[model samples]
Target chain A: MYAWFFRELLPGPLWVRIILTVVLLAAVVYGLMEFVFPWLSEYSPLGDVTLEDG
Target chain B: MTPPLPRHADPAQRSVAAATRRQRRRRPLGAKIMGGFGEILITLGVLGLLFVVWELWWTGIEAESDRQDSLDEFYANMPARPAVSDGDDGDNDDDGPNPADFEVCYTLDDGTEIGCADHMRAQTGSEQIMGTVYAPRLGENWAAPIRYGVSATQIDRGGVGHYPNTQWPDEPGNFALAGHRNTNASMLGNQDSLQIGDPIYVVSYDGIYVYEVRERQVVLPNQTEVLNPVPSDSAAEAEFGVLTFTTCHPMFSNRERLIHHAEIVDFVPIGAEAPADLVHHEPITQMFYAGGAG
Candidate 1:
């Protein structure tokens, strides 16, 4: 699957493709860290420190 | 296998042979679909691991910096003490300042005085830094800024949060606080290590309210009576202050809440000398004594 992305989907030569892959990977990681993970953690119990009035 | 190729076969013929082999090796439609699914599953698995790293490690990095910034702001804004020599310290065995010497720091909406514990009410949808908490038993240099609310905006910043509904330190009721136990800097990660008689110090704008641990209990998350003013006794009038620290129990899980209850044993006003047993963090302790004549 990754081979297909690298060889066919990316519109670049070998050097350019390597750079693009690194940039894309960094973007994905940044998105996950800044947006997805925080949103997902809201549903997780590990960070639920507050006690609800019962 | 039909016949041996010439020593110098045509390059075009060899290329055709390679293409045919590749065609033969092509997967069936079902296999192709299954392989796609497998790839997706692997990606998801990697993402799950990344999430764990983000939760346990990355979040702490952000929170620790936030905690430091908050502490810096609190110390910078700390009120300077007025020079006044109250003769009460000469004869008293306690070297701490007289609570009466400090002006009232909080009052109810109706203007009823709440005394000198530097009580700051948590506003809805916002947070306020109320103080800093120091526990020698937790760590030698362990101090987390205490904030007004226990929500993500507060606790996620690597600080214990005061329950707005609960009483403040030195008040005649349960002064409850909540903190993350295993993630977001794990402010109270060592809560289970607290033994009976361990001192927990809360240094607010007005003074430091010292509490001695009396009990530790693990209770269901829904068992919020532990936060009551007179814990487990809603009907009784609270005679003395109780400091309650609540965190997710069993580390890395929120199945229950670990609660440590401590009774208010001493109060050292901001201008007074910190108690001998107080956690000796120089900059932090100095903030309390900044305005003092001493």
Candidate 2:
């Protein structure tokens, strides 16, 4: 239960924190993998009008 | 440093050295007692404080790691339901978990093979070697992984060694558990305190079972027969629905296995949905975190 996910995840115990941390980090990575990172191409300007926090 | 701080220097330095020598010779009342005998007590007090910190902070870290690993192993290995075999119409489940994902393992009485999942739900306040032993005889409602057992290492780094091949929780027989002799964690930490008929329990993913301490058995680790579900290790011999809990005697090391023998009385459902009693009955909140309100 106690993990480094304290920043989010379950609100009790060190394990919860760790688990939550890892879970959220994984979620973010998953989002980036599926959404933001896929649309990169040469003609498309690197600078975008909007960028959701990756 | 500077040629051994001048023994006799300028007036101020000379005075300071003289005062230093005088202070060494003029032991204060407290210092006078330091060498007489109190020093040993003071030293012991400091050591005890250090031991307390080690018991608390570092032990908690180790416990947390073990618990996390245990849970991971459980989730990774256990199937949603028990595994099934051929000719069983896919209903047979040999290796999967029942609903709550409780994975069981076996170990010897020497305290080796402390499972990685031991630290899964560890309370982080004090690293007092603690955990509950789920005894079948203690009934499903009475068991919990309370802080039991003695701390073998500096960080209280240890595991609850399964008494090899004892009856499983659901199996008809006694399931024994042993932890450290930690007073705060109690149980194994305080093996001497467990009295006869005291209510105990095992908090498992499947359910909770209430047990009553019936007797104590002081035996060497080699007397493995006591842990046998049949008391003889013969599969043909059915179990006696008993529970055996053990810990080190007189604290410190495993000089002897202080044991509590009990019997199961009730088997409460843990997280089963089909059983209406699971919804209507009092829910066991401590075992699984998101288990309440069902």
Candidate 3:
């Protein structure tokens, strides 16, 4: 739904499309840097701790 | 009347009919794209390998040429400081063993001394500095110095400025030669590839001169005193028969100019053994390199 909305609606104008592209890239990188997955994986016993490698 | 088909065509007819039907079944775009992508990857892989090979070849030329310069410079250095290294020992005068100290008696196009005031003050740019550069060691024949920028012409005709303080066919002393470093086809820019101790010869109607590389230095633009008749050193050294050539360094930008310094080794008279062509002058000086100074 988010991908479809971004492709069909959020890009209502050229300026908005440019802004959306920048924001989406920034968010993707930010999410990775915040270790969102690693933090959650740490609490789960089944998660492979060795994969994080400190 | 039977229009006959060749015997080979009869056997291939069945295969051609099968291929025709199969080809008539058009391929879907997605399948076609996948097949094309595979071919593209293969082509790109081969190209990348060839590119690597080309790069290696280019790198070899640069390295080999520079190595030749390095070896030339090494061979050019001295076994020991010629007796002159003892500080104020050698006469170090204009009369000192220089190939440059000679009377240059010749008339210019304007019917004046070889380097009359009007001749030295000639204008700069494409039309003016477009004269022949005759170096006896490298090549004895006169090559027209390419003026303006390197792009304007392949043969560099150096800058239009005078030797600043020297006479035409300059008297026995250090003579300064300046050229625009950023210009196209400049002798200075082409010299980026020059190793230390390379020999440079500049001949004219006056006489033929052989300049052996002495030192290379990067100095401020105002360091013009080096052009003094005698290079002002810490101690009173020998008077010079010097040829100081300057150009802006790094080829394009002129924040500083690289200087190549040499002393006149042998000033051959005009009708003397100067070869008619520069290419012929090589073998004689090939084994003879300049002596090193401290």
Steric clash pairs (candidate 1): none
The TM-scores that each candidate's chain B achieves against the reference are 0.78, 0.46, 0.43
Looking at model 3 chain B, report the run of 10 residues with the lowest lDDT sum: B151-160
Span of ten consecutive residues with least summed lDDT in model 2 chain B: B272-281
Over A1-54, each residue of candidate 3 has an lDDT whose tens digit, in order, gives 233355446734557887987898668645643454334423422211001111
Against the native complex, each candidate's DockQ, computed on alpha carbons, is 0.66, 0.01, 0.01
Candidate 2 C-alpha lDDT tens digits along A2-53: 1112323357545776686778767865554445433321122211111111
Lowest summed lDDT across 10 adjacent residues in model 1 chain A is found at: A4-13
Docking class of 2: incorrect
Q: For candidate 3, lDDT tens digit of each residue in B1-294?
A: 335445456536845654665567658989777877887798668645544343223223433343344323332431221122333556555322333333544432343232212322342343433223444333333232312222212222222234534433344455566544433223344545545666666534333456677887776555665656665663444343576666665544554556667876655443234433443534323322122323
lDDT of candidates 1 onward, in order: 0.78, 0.44, 0.44
Q: How many Å off is the CA of B237 in candidate 2?
A: 2.0
For DockQ, candidate 1 versus 2, the one ahead is: 1
Best by DockQ: 1
lDDT tens digits, residues B144-219, model 1? 8887788888899988888889987646789999998889999999999999999998877767777899999899
